[model samples]
Target: MSAELRRELSRLDTLANALDSQFRIPGIGMRIGWDGILGLVPGVGDAVTLLPAAYLLYKGHRLGARRMTLMQMALNSGIDLAIGAVPLLGDLFDIGFKANKRNVALLRRDIEARIEEVA
Candidate 1:
C-alpha cells in the first residue's frame, strides 16, 4: 500500500477503535467506546454516530474495495444504525457490535487482497 493509504487506514483504525472500544469495564471484562456513550441519547446520538461509520464506508469505496466488500461494510453499518435505533438495548448492542472495527477489518482484507493481486 502507498504511504498515504497506510496513514489513512491507521487514522481510521484509531478513530474506529476510539468510537467502538476505547474503555474497559474492569471487573466485568466488558468494554465500551464513544458510540456507547453517545448512544445514551435517543435519536440524536444514533444519528451522530452514523456519520463516522458512513465516512469509513466512503473511505473504503475510495480505496477501491470490491462491491461485495462495500456491501458487507454497509450491512455492518446498517445493522449498527438499525438496531442501535432502539433506546437502551441499542446502546448496549453498540457496546458489543463494534461495527466500525469490523468494517476496518474488511477494508484491510480487501486492500491486502488487492495488493497481492498487483504483486
Candidate 2:
C-alpha cells in the first residue's frame, strides 16, 4: 500500500478503536468504547456518535471505494443507528455492533482488493 493509504488506514483504525474498543471492562474483560458510553444517553447519544461514522463513509468515498462497498458501509451505520436508538438493548448492541470498526474493515478490504486488481 502507498504511504498515504497506509496513513489513512492508520487514522481510520485509531478512530474505530476509540469508538468501539478503547477500554476493557473489569473482571469479565469485555471491551467497550465511546460509542457504548455515549449510547447510554437517551434520545441523542446514538445521533451524536453518528458523526464519526459519517466521517468514515466520507473517507471511504474519498479513498475510491467501490459503490457497493460504500453502500454496505452505509448500511452498517444505518443498522447500528436504527437499532442503537433502543433503550437498554441499544447500549448492549453498541458494545457488540461496533459500526465504525466494521466500516473501517470494510473500507480496508475494498481498498486492498482494488489495489490487488491493479497490480
User: Residue-wise lDDT of candidate 2 within 8-65, one digit each (tens)?
Assistant: 9999999999999999999989899998899999988899999999999999999999
Count of residue pairs whose backbone atoms collide, per candidate: 0, 0
> Which residue pairs clash within candidate 2?
none
Best by lDDT: 2
lDDT by residue (63-106, candidate 1, tens digit) is: 99999999999999999989999988898899889999999999
Write down the TM-score of every candidate: 0.93, 0.98
Over 4 Å off, model 2: none
Worst 10 residues of 1 by lDDT: 30-39
Residue-level error in angstroms, candidate 2, position 114? 0.3
Q: Give Cα-based local distance difference scores for all models.
A: 0.92, 0.94
The worst-scoring run of ten residues by lDDT in candidate 2 lies at 38-47
